[model samples]
Target: MYSLKLVTFVVLSSIPYFCYGAKREDFDLQKMFEDMGEEGNKMRDECFTENEMSLADLHDYDKAEDIPEKELCFYKCFFQKSYVVDKDGKVIIESIKAIEEVKDLEESDRETFTNCLKEIKPVLECKDMVEFEKCFDQILM
Candidate 1:
């Protein structure tokens, strides 16, 4: 359950990272996830399983280099499943903002998060996870 919270935090923070000239548009985040049902949960479990990661491993990433390639891709999978990232792997900021968690953020935190998202250009590949993680830290940590 704790791992799920970690995954949720990671998703909301990094969801805005994958934009690459992709047009932003608002989406019904609640409806989107509702439609997904257990698909997201399945992906989360699969990512952890495939990466051989445990909840303990989640806290071990103190640095970008400390994150494994598999873990980075796991983030991508989460965002993709949420549709915050398109099939082409481009992030839609509006879609991210539509998320209930992101929406509920305090005003100042939301501004910081928005800025971080705009500044970071993530490719949804293993190599760029560090950049996204760095931006996420600045916003929420």
Candidate 2:
């Protein structure tokens, strides 16, 4: 469970690199939120509060190190609530592809992301998340 936190760090930490210092213009956070819709927004707010996390926390994470427990669970909560992962812990490929960040990706990059999604374990666990983090790092970082 805790190890999943590190994986979440790796996934979100990649944002800084691609977003170029986590700038809104580059990352379009507003658009991302809008894309998330009402349910997703509520989930995001709840997860942020529950985890005591903010965008700054996402920026502060170091992908080279293990992710903190709160942060990891934050991602997991967001994933589950947003239907990125189902109740049974299966990746929802379409939902992931629909994310603003994923939509902004270039065709090849999107394909790579899709491939990574396909590689995820059937039942998500900390180890699976760790592998996902590694895969995300290879693609984005």
Best by TM-score: 1
* Model 2 regions lying over 4 Å from their true place: 1-41, 49-59, 100-104, 126-128
lDDT of 1 by residue, 59-129 (tens): 33335565567666766666565565667656667766766677788888877877776677755575665
Q: Write the per-residue lDDT of candidate 2 for residues 13-131, one digit (tens) a residue.
A: 45434333323352353234333445455677787887787655543334423555565566667767655578888877876665666677788888987897788785355334544
Error of 2 at 102 (Å): 3.1
Best by lDDT: 2
| Model 1 TM-score (2 dp) | 0.61
**What local lDDT score does residue 110 receive in model 1, on the 0 to 100 scale?**
77
| Model 1 poorest ten-residue lDDT run | 17-26
CA shift of 106, model 1, Å: 2.2
RMSD in Å for all candidates: 10.7, 8.0
The collision pairs in model 1 are: none
Error of 1 at 95 (Å): 1.7
